[model samples]
Target chain A: MSDPILEVKNLKKYFRVTNGVLKAVDNVNLSIQRGETFGLVGESGCGKSTLGRTIMRLYNTTEGQVLFNGENVHQLKGSRLKQFNRDMQMVFQDPYASLNPRMTVGDIIAEGIDIHRLSSGVKRRERVSELLQTVGLPEEHASRFPHEFSGGQRQRIGIARALAINPQFIVADEPVSALDVSVQAQVINLFKRLQEENGLTYLFISHDLAMVKHIADRVGVMYLGSLTEVAQSHELYRNPLHPYTVALLSAIPIPDPEVERKRERIILEGDVPSPINPPPGCRFFARCPKAMPQCQVDTPRWIEVETDHYVACHLYK
Target chain B: MENILEVKDLKVSFHTYAGEVQAVRGVSFDLKKGEVLAIVGESGCGKSVTSQTIMRLIPSPPSIIKEGSILFDKKIDLVQLTLKEMESIRGSEIGMIFQDPMTSLNPTMTIGKQITEGLVRHQGLSKEKAQKEAIELLSLVGIPRPETRIKQYPHEFSGGMRQRVMIAISLACRPKLLIADEPTTALDVTIQAQIIDLLKDLQEKIGSSIIIITHNLGVVADIAQRVVVMYAGKIVEQGTVDDIFYRAQHPYTWGLLHSILRLDDDEKSELVPIEGMPPDLLAPPQGCAFAARCPHAMNICLNEDPQTQIIQDEHSMACWLMDKRMRTEIR
Candidate 1:
């Protein structure tokens, strides 16, 4: 648990829009252990994607630093930066949009391999076929375009592309959300299998709580560009400390009719407040059911409330 | 209870360049008066096509209705109704709420006009009367400051609020039957809860039967009284909520139930996902659509499409495994 592969310290990624500075990701701090899955769960526009991208060094950090194996990712230069790129990879949300239509499935998967100069000639083709079979696709599928495949198959191709470079870490952003439930299960199982077989670390980001709970060893709940709670998978679901986390968990509709009928859903009132010049205190102060008077004026300090459970709320303080 | 809408032997096909995509094949279901019926299926299963067909919204050039009848209120056949007749019935007799609120609502026009347009056209209310009624409708859908919010355009509202506006627009005339095609699919889970609650409240108050098309089993369990499970453009199972969730018979429904990650599932428990993709509707398989993916598929399942078998009152499935002889053979 102490062997952290990556650490994000006070990371902030902001955009200077016409209206004001859009605080997409503000002062986020978390670390991913070696060979451990860290799940980031949040609503749309909460900056979970921005955080993932920032850590991947796709976006220049506005403040703070991202350390990969105790080395500053943002400060990397020349050969070090190129090595960093080869070490980390990303799987996007939409398989249809992320994949290039004009390119064959083999070319798409081998794009990373070609850039890294990992293999060439017949060897490169062999590697691509191996990747295709690894992701449960036929080796013949290498010649076909992405359009020929189903949504689930297209997603498999996307995963194959990510695994082409054999990166130590992968940021899977809503990887299974676009696929159907049955297909999603298959892809999730594939992800788990890949992690075990390759000893890879993952930053699994999604809006779906149930998916996050299933794949994540440690789960972090984000709201309005800030993390509200971070706990072990079972602990967070069993006893969520943050009010926003409680509401988020309660809001997820359980599939069982009996459970749905009996459970009291804590539907959060109003929409998420604008991230542009967010309120003085807690961002969730307005919609929070258990909001204190101080919550409106003072920001909550991020604290380790329990042995492994961390929360950023005045109530816990 | 009486059925507000009944669809019989419905088949819809889209003539694309590749081939005639049989979007919906012999789908049959009924919605009881004042009851919420959920059509649950994955994308391209014809759930959306079935709902759009109810409003006669499917364009006939590329898409054609091969054969079927959509009987509304036990008197009017929506399938036979012309575009002109559909105009009169749409929003007045039957209304629809689309999946994406962002695209469904007109961006150029104010939400107030969008809501009032339906009331004025459908109910024949005067402009002034419609505007006042629109404000009430807006408030009913839980939009704060309806007076001000109504004046604003669709761009001004959030995703959740825009969906509320869409619901308000749909319910403006208080149609007898409402077809919400994935109404909450685009919104956040918390907002989804709010919209589901609003729909439940409005259904009770308006006494309108609803046909909700969605793939989320959780959403189905939350609001729907009855469930219709579709696969490869055909309904595999139809039953009460309890029947579908607890005692489902179809292999597809079982796969769907087992695939999802349950909140209470054991941490180490592996999901039992259906291995294969849904069969292509272009040249659909000769037999049961789900036979390709079903673990319990028999020789007959691959050769013949099973007839709808009645398990109990209001509980039926179209599966060869449900046959008495097959069940005994399996045992």
Candidate 2:
């Protein structure tokens, strides 16, 4: 789709430990079109967060490339890399730990501005104030510290900071997971408005399938460090092909009792295998209900099952 | 069906530095014998606090049951129970399963040890007897190879398995009432279903009442016979599963139902999210906590609180719109 805004090719991040190299992120490939929200979902420790951070260049990639705007960001150095940093930013998962306690909300959002040398003196202050307003926070909040605001407000501050650099791409890693559900709505709506206003491409990383369905144009399912499925939001939710995706979707609790009672659940067995030593063949084989013998031996390559819908599972193979 | 636990006019508050955080304004509900009662609310609505309070688990000094009586066994007022009395009731008379199983289970101890520790303390059984019972508990929760798995530590078990172990431990005493606070929120959908079904089957087998505290409505459909919708620490709606699902009254309840993002309803619902944020617990609204966000909010809603009105025989709602008195009769 017009070469996609960002393309991930065999992106692998391995960590050497007492055990052999832990393939925390092994051979994951995904792409996000311009102004589209690509949701990356999996249970905790599935390397979804690592994949997001690596894509954002927060963690240096050990293998593969993150092609941003058709340029391999890892290859860049010095000033060019600094400029690239301004083009992309990250919204961390934990609002409590992500914001600097020492810095004021204004200073936190202004840090990127200061680094990019985007403005001078009062102009930077005005820009920060503008950003705060844009994110639906009061201008007076600029003087307040991160500790003063609620978890949701702090996340908004983080979002404002990401937008400070006038970024084309943003990796929001579980931005609402830490916030109260009431405030989660506020922040999610703010994200939608900002997306429409800024036309930003987002790799929205979350384990919450319902939230993903609400925001994302396309959804990508990750298993142990591999991309198992990717499809348009409606299609994936309606007809989930991958066993992992089906299991994940069945897990989301609906708020209505009638619908909740009627919906049959896909109960996955066993825990996600250790990323340090992911299972041979399909990473989902151990837990997948539809897993075949071949699924335990030959890694299922991701293939297009339908128009714009991809699944990597022996069921389809 | 006999009522196992009846919480009446329960008021809980935390004495924060800011002020007394009125967490549960006055929440009340009942869990019938062998039935499931789901307490649904957004965070800070006091669903968790209400459950924890019944278990006498709310941290004191800051947290206090300012006013109300939590009647368990249809007679015992939990607030009146002493520390020693509450300890006896915790595992044997009333079992509680928390949100995160990994943190709930002792990391250093083997699953067997952790499960048996409670039995040794509460049941006053011998170590050998408790160890034997531990295997049965594990198997009861549907964990495979209970013999080998019990010897492993919490880290060795998967999230779902660890949760199952926690459930087994909770069910060890075979308490008459089980309090599970967001038991499956941390688990994935498939694992969540398995846990829900296991709980349902356990409730049927043990004939113990289940009080599930959660924000997800989907879970209530599977387990709950009656649903209690809480808002800003007060019971906004209470009814049977059918009553609340098909004939939901309160605007807050409506907001919650509509907000649930369904895979099928995506095409039907035109991105209509609930308009406003939850009221600040520090300073809840004077009238209705949700009045600020309610689209149908009238003059009385902003100034005077509306008492709950019976919508059906067993269903009720707390909203100005539901108040027949608020409606004027014109000549």
Candidate 3:
């Protein structure tokens, strides 16, 4: 509707392995409106995390531009880069490995604040406590080490750390995958509440489709370093255009026993092809049930099949 | 159908440095022959502990089976079996698979050797015969190029394939019971579906009773005929798959069901998360363990643990809300 808070144009990130260059994120494009949650979903090694990190400038882009608020994120340096860092943050997947075990929870949360020189001494302490409270942790929890807290509590601390710098955009990469089901619900709710309160834009990346559907205004499905489908959460789930998207949706086991038993699942055959020197055609051609002879040779063009829904598949064309 | 496995009043505890942690408190359930039973719970809820205890996998020095009997084939109390005798039954009579395939599988050995080792030791098959059997097992689990893949090490296989190899190894001896502890948790949703389907297909062919231990209700619904809902080291609810999903009684079970972001549901509906964490295993609460987090926890629920109330022929739950007296009081 309004100007996109974050925009990606022909983004690519490649790692030169011994064999070949691993195209982790290839020719990707996306735009996230202010206060919108853009969910990125795919299996492991599907470049969801890579795309998130590339957008956050955690990795140097192999190609293309990340425009944050009309400013090229790749070109920003020194004070401007520092300002970008303050405005954007990331909540990592693993709470156990992400947080330093040696650091106190308060110190960990305030690391961003300290780096940005936002507060000092008593004020810093108060800010840390307030952030801890914001993420549903008590003030006393700030004194405890990461090991003292449970997995769920540790995740809350991670969220608090991300929110410390008051970032307008946060890239949460598989933030709740490690958490238990009930605890995951709590964290998701917290994310929703924080987004509402702060008017934040989130690049919420996860392999869990159901979770992404719950939190994301729009959802994007990645398959082996390329986005296969992107659409409104409800629209995508209801009528998945890409064969990969349809299979992925069908594969997710519903908790309802009756539906689960009755449903005809499209269980995709074969593992995701290696990203290093990936196949020339559609990445999902190997396993796609509806793949044709042309699909094996011709790379499908990304097209807007519906009013807002987009898909990259020969079938859509 | 006769129950293949029956766990009665099973109580297990770990002797920690801090204190004795009661992991499983008077848990009991029965698994019919050729049926799939799923034990669903969050971490520290003792679902894994119960399954491990059934397989006699927990280390005994720190972990102790305090009271109860795990009767296999209605005669053998697995708890009473000596280590020597249990070893005989471990793989041949009951096979177990863990979550992480990389760790469970040996790095040095070929996939063929790993699968055949059990066949040779337990079934007394010749090296050639065992190797042939291993290839067949691999093919059975849907691993392509079973002959060539069998020679390769675990590292050569993909995550999904490695898991298939794990399944192949587990089913080599053709045990009467197969215990899969979060078999697909580490896998992607598509791979997870494939694995579940493979397990179901293999179950039909082998006809071994399955006990799938997982925290995911979705996975439970996909593969299991019966479901057991555990909370804070206790079996809070047990019923048929339909009963557990549609007619759940325990507040904990309801909370668990409600908390999950279901694909079929409207995306806008706010998830009702169970407030507060699972009780500390070291010093669990005196009353119902889930009472603290349960939305409908009553005074009695906070004060005393409720006894298992049989709802129907095969459905049961342990909750004050399920009690006839509580229902009458509410009316």
Candidate 4:
């Protein structure tokens, strides 16, 4: 009913190699509503991360456009670009590698505040202390370096830094994958609480299906460099349409021994094909159990097979 | 099932500049012959250290096995064995599959050479004989075009294929005991499932006892017959898979079960994460190691560690809440 907060239109990102052109993100289209989390999931090297980077304008797009609030994100410059940077923020995967080891926790959180001229001096210090308390960290930890804190605490600092800018949209690339299970739950809960309190939209990127199912409102499944399915999170998990989505969902092992032992897993055969100079047909044709001869030559078109559920597969066609 | 490996009161510590990091503190467990035992724990909990210590792989000086005995096959204390003696048993009698297949494999060596290296040394096979056997081993792990793929280097293989190669190399000598430390951690969910299935299939065919150390509870349930939950370098709970999943008694175990998002779990259920961090191993708590983060910690739990209480057959945990003596105090 409301205008989408972010719209990605036929986006493509490619890298030239000595051998050939590697298609990292190819012809992806997506729309995210305001104040809702859109989860993008795929296995390793599936271009989910590349798509996130491209949407964030970290990488120069090969083709197509990214629209944020009806304006081309790539075309913005000067003060508008600065405003865009403040409005849109990113949370990286590894807190150890992302945060500056030399900077104190206060400095790390205040960097965004100072850059945006949101506060200065004592006010900046006060804001940093407030953020620390918001994320469940002690204010005394502000002066301490990141190395002194544990993995979970460091991640909370990272979240604090992202929240410092008061961004409306955040692209979290595998934010909790590096954390331990108990710590992961804490961080995921933090993300949810922050989203509710800030009225924020998130593009949550991860390879973990269960976490995506738990945190996201809408879910997209990426294969190779293309989206194979998009649906409401519960809808996708309950009745996955695309062959790839089915295989991907079934591959996740349930923690309960009874459920895991009773359920028959759909273990797809063979490795994912190389993204460089990919085949003309469907990317999943090699491993799809329901693949048809036509699927080997013609790529399936993305279509809405049901209300609010989209799939790209000949089986649905 | 008879015991294949018995580790009793194993205390391993690392001498660091800061202090002595007690990595594995008083850990004791046994592996039944042909059974799969999964050691489940987060990082810094010493699951990896415990498994590597079984292989005598940790270098000395920095690491010291302060106390305990690692008895193999009801005799032969592995902790007492010299490096030279351990080498004889390393590949032939015991094998290990490391976490990262990419780095674990030698980049320059061909897959065939890597696989045959163990067969040649441990089995006294000729170069030609070992090479032929290497092809069979690769195919046995479900790798296609074994002859041609064997000649290719590690970089040419994908992550899953490289993991398969690692499995082939580990099973080359058909060791009686295999320790796989996070064998599928680096791979994708699909590849992880494939590797798990491969490990399960091969374990049945080889009839060797396996010690799988991983943080993934799902993978443990999929492959392991028994589970051990570790915290701060010590095991807090251990039981059969059914017991750990259905009737777990430890508060720490409950936290783990509640924290993880199971595939079948409804979205409405909230995760009850453990509140605090694991205790520093350099100066581990005198009480229960999990007491700092545990929700059911009692006054005694802060002063003294609870003894292991057997909740049921083959299921035990170290927690004051499970002790009947503490029930009166709680009332």
Identify the runs in model 3 with alpha carbons over 4 angstroms from their true place: none
lDDT tens digits, residues B178-261, model 3? 999999999999999999999999999999999999988888888999999888889999999999999988888888888998
Higher-TM-score candidate among 2 and 4? 4
Residue range with the least summed lDDT across 10 consecutive positions in model 1 chain B = B263-272
User: Candidate 4's residue-wise lDDT over B1-331, tens digit each?
Assistant: 7899999989999999999999999899889999999999888999999999999999998999999999999988999999999999998899899999999999999999999999989899999999999999999999999999989999999999999999999999999999999999999999999999999899889998999999999898888999999998888899999999989989888999899997776654777788888889889998988878877777889999888878888999888887886778668
DockQ of each: 0.82, 0.49, 0.88, 0.82
1 versus 2: better DockQ goes to: 1
Give the backbone clash total of model 2.
3
Residue-level lDDT tens digits of model 3 in A1-317:
57699999999999999999999999898889999999999999999999998898889999999999999998999999999999999999999999999999999999999988999999999999899889988899889899998888999999999999999999999999999988999999999999999999999999999999999999999999999999999999999899898889999999888888799988889999899998798888899889899999998988898988999999876
* TM-score of model 3 vs. true structure: 0.98
Question: Which is superior by lDDT, 2 or 4?
Answer: 4
Q: Give the per-residue lDDT of model 4 (tens digit) for A25-54.
A: 988999999999999999999999999998
- Between prediction 1 and prediction 3, the one with superior lDDT is 1
Kindly list the per-residue Cα lDDT of model 1 for residues A1-317, writing each as its tens digit: 39999999999999999988999999999999999999999999999999999999999999999999999999999999999998999999999999999999999999999988999999999999999999999999999999999889999999999999989999999999999999999999999999999999999999999999999999999999999999999999999999999998888889999998899888889998899988789999999999889999988999999988999999986
What's the ranking of the predictions by DockQ, best on top?
Answer: 3, 4, 1, 2
Query: Model 1, stretches more than 4 Å misplaced?
Result: B328-331
Better of 2 and 3 by DockQ: 3
Report the lDDT tens digits of candidate 2 across residue range A1-317.
Answer: 46598999989999989978888898888778998999888888889999988888878888899998888988888888988898899998899999999988989999988877889689998998899999888999999999988787888899999999899999999999876565677788888889999999899999888888889999998888888889988888889888778778776666666677577776666666787766679888777788788888998888998988988887885
Task: Name every residue pair that clashes in candidate 2.
Answer: A251-B189, A254-B218, A255-B217
